[model samples]
Target: ERPEEKLEKPCAAVAPKEEALKPKDMDRSTSDDDDEEADGYQQKGVSIDDLSDDWVEAQMKDVTVAVIGNVDSGKSTLVGVLTKGGLDDGRGLARAKVFNFSHEAANGRTSSIAQEIMGFSQSGEQVLIDRMGTSTANSRNQTWQQVVSQSERLVTFSDLCGHEKYLKTTIFGLVGQCPDYTMIIVNANAGFQRMSREHLGIALALRIPFFIVITKIDIAPQNVFDENLAQLHKIVKSNAVKRQPLVVTSEDHLEQAATGIYGKQVCPMFCISNVTGEGLPLLRSFLQRLPSRLQDSGLFKPPSSPAEFHIDSIYVVPGVGLVVGGVVRSGRICPGQHLLLGPDKVSQFKPVMVKTIQYKRVTVEMAESGQHCSFALRSLVKRETLKKSMFRKGMVMLGPELQPKAIWSFKAEARWTVGFDFSSQSILNCALVSAHFASICPAAVCGASRNVDVPVQLCRSHGDQD
Candidate 1:
């Protein structure tokens, strides 16, 4: 055998071994790099999972407030000013911005369950901006989605009707809409009207924490404002009500009020001028600081639990067959997940599949607990066109395990630990009746806040500015 041939054979064997060992060394180095990167990331105090913008936005905190008051008390006007960054013309130019109907605009009153969104950035900048800067004469409102997308924390206002004629709708707003807080608007000139007392009594009876807003200070005389303020302090602190008034004039007072707003007797009051923008900043700050009562009370369920959704309204989209919009009370809702939609007229639930989900006007693949979502649904059963007509507001959408047989009548024990009266009885009866009046539709409720006045769509996405 030749010496050269012998050398070549050994060299080839050595080459194969080296090649085999190379990938192993490379694999170790690659894994080491990943581990080191992950370690470095952890050291920085942030989760890699949270880097997704949608996830962060979906989890943003939102507070829902129901604005209630007597006729011409300025519920819509206050909301419009805060959200649109526009001042009222004293002729309800701002009020006209939030009206849901032509008649509402014509009359300058909110007659339905109307909603508006005002967002705050992490730095506390309002999400809304006047298209024409520094122009108080008019404001071109930004789209709700645009405001939502820009906001880190959102404040939702459910503007209920102020007139006695719309009392039923207001009842629906109070009971079914599930507002976190209620702001009772009082006219300084009126000095606490009849409906104002009724609303205050209702809030007290329901144990819903409330605050007062005295509007029209720009036109209201100082004596009238002082008189109304004194009246509020008197009524709120009375033995029957048992709440203390903390007039928020500074940051210290606001912090104190927000800290105890839930399950506490601290009722914060503000004097607001929708036209002159007096005391507006303080109210906005309070709203931003307002804690969510639902979140604190376990009513804001975690997404890990079984899904429970309350249907408030239904609509048929032109492109999509049927859609349901409501609040997701518990668990997670994902597109393509199977769920039960029911307690129909026959007290039976229908199996359904969620085809799409939208939150805050942005398309979402999954909706977590405490977010308002619209599910574009596909009925498991062969249903005809106009499937939406079959569903109603009082219905519940449940995860299979949570479904229960429908009952026409059932007796349950409830503890009425407080003093009761005929008014309370009527309120309770109204609650039962309102629960049955399932078609008082809201365009949608955005859960990230208790209810963002807006749209929920199934097989559809709704445009904003409601």
Candidate 2:
């Protein structure tokens, strides 16, 4: 047997022994009253080492969390501090490490989606900055591999654009990335802003569970911080969210908040400072204990079903002609598998061969459902022609057995906002509407009526020309 399998054997054997001892321990009570009293105190604490190995193995979870708020809320800096295990220098030192483009660094703002990951061991210890002597880029890649190989759980933070000009990019991250939770960063000095409320509305509309993080507490004055906290409390307790806001101040609060995160009974708030590294340990503890919100029934499709992979990005590697990076939405994909890539400008799928598969930059033979991976495609079309073809976003790769087609028109039942009256016979021109079915795409509202379904035409762009 493999080493992992052998490790599980001892744990399974101990469970039955413990079960047998339970009855004998209960029978030894001197009297019925004593037995009842013993039962009340019979609950035992199971440490990580004492639990079954299967439980430990199942602890290797992957959760994606989206970070959002208004501009200058220190979203990128906070993420950098958490992932790199370094405190900020109060002048964009940590955030500079997260920016991918020169313009973003120059402006000190993120205009696109940036992702960083943090890993926790079985003992709930972070393992991001343990490597020694490697260059910055190499260290990051190596750390990811080490974390995936050794850690018990991984949390991926998708830092999205917080500026108003890049609101579309932020919306795409929220609707397309399928994050398990959201962390809204609020600047203590600025209090609540318009863009922050916009982000909160989107999260609430999607029914995603979220928590608030008040940043820059080290620099903000006591009065300003308290005022900001009061405003946050008022908004969270309002009729819309109706959530009880709990201020996390201790390890006990962290444990309680993490355990009840999915219950939605309370919204935990944390005051942190990336510059001085204050309250970071408590935040890390909460992340380590945060359970994945994805249920087993909703995680993946049946293995017997047809494979479907959603294409979020397309890349042309130096030697590897065309590569597509996405998540496996259903079934499994292996090297040398044949799938159909579509829907082209002509609304048809073309056959393509999977040449190679990669997971976390490590080559693998097969990738199962619910895992993000990159697949190198051996296209039947010529390289130059393939570049000119329609291989952009909102495309998919599927088993050829199940034929698929591109759709341009669909009817949806939507609730009309208050004070917005529409007539069934009137055609609403240039009405920008965002829709998400299999993928997120903007559509033009062609026609609508009160108390009835609305017809919309999907567009590749948001402009009227589309």
Candidate 3:
């Protein structure tokens, strides 16, 4: 049980004459008596209902942008380029591992102290190396949040996946949860395949800020270029992508293609060979120019305040406590600042403690949106419990009380990737939610309460007969 209870001072603190009219605070009395679930005590103690929506929003944090794409599409390699330096020099890749900040003792100006903390030789670049994670799927988000907690200034980077299949499942976890950004990559060597079309559709549907990164162009054949381009045009045209495929074959040859392709799209195309030393400078220049492109799209703007934050991943840090990782999203978060865990499944909670904060590789007083970070909780909370309680899925984590609308049924427009009969008990996985259940959404029009001719949406890839 919590030891000390803070109460507001009396005229301002004292109960008004109207208190006599209140329903004897019976719920409070009972809840206080029960030590196990003290929700009532927690509620009666703090009232933010008196606060205005503007004030509440003023406290809201910025959302984070997670860059994702198909495996080996150079997601990590590209991120390495943007953060460290042009990959051509090889310094970027090496320095990215020990990127940090330094304090200018003479002028009190703090620059990237990477050299000081990791004791690596200093370069002229202002970038750092990010420790993504050991676990490909579970720990990617944690690495991002750690970056947020340790940096003095806000930072943003991609959450590149290790596998191709995981992209489809992980994409939605980032959708609609935060006001952030995304990047998509494609391989010039493979051209635009059928599976790439599926991935493209998902990105288009979300209306995310994504660019087509054509990697491994050094080996691309010029003879089949027209055929590949035509195929890509057909696929993109059918999907209503509204933009033509950007081809980056030669820095000189693809110059016109690169410049014109981004007509209305912000994410540009680049011909980059992670192996060879060609077109690296152009790619670097393009990246340095991207923030401006985003700005023109009205997607990149500096925050007005420091209350913004985004939930990237939730995990239990052994010994230290529950670790929540994410970007500041918008505003600043400091040690000791109270954060509302919000209405939980069984109860509502007020301000909770911000025990610690880390960005990149060092601790900071506070952090802002676009920065990656993680921190420990003063009290304990289960990672799974927090996920369920908060309705979070991968990148999108919400607090308790904002319960997922309990759907007794949902009309799943599932594509049977593998041919199967509907009578066979369809059980495709809900990859994004990471949960699976029998395909048993009830048919509302049925009078006998029997599962009948349900409206089942089928995918062309999978065989499902009506």
Model 3: residues with Cα > 4 Å off, grouped in runs: 1-74, 77-155, 162-164, 176-181, 233-239, 244-263, 292-312, 316-319, 327-332, 342-351, 368-372, 380-466
TM-score for all predictions? 0.75, 0.79, 0.51
lDDT of 3 by residue, 288-335 (tens): 333322223332224334243445456676665667776444444456
Of 1 and 3, the candidate ahead on TM-score is 1
Off-target runs (Cα >4 Å) in candidate 2 are 1-60, 130-140, 296-304, 380-389, 416-430, 436-440, 451-466
Against the true structure, whose TM-score is highest? 2
**In each prediction, how many residue pairs overlap at the backbone (N, C-alpha, C within less than 3 A)?**
4, 0, 44
Local distance difference test values of all predictions, in order: 0.66, 0.70, 0.40
Q: How well does model 1 score by local distance difference test?
A: 0.66
Query: Which 10-residue window in model 1 sums to the lowest lDDT?
Result: 6-15
Residue 213 in model 2: shift from native, Å?
Answer: 0.9
**What does the lDDT read for residue 352 in candidate 1?**
66
Q: How accurate is candidate 3 locally (lDDT)?
A: 0.40
lDDT of 1 at 407: 36
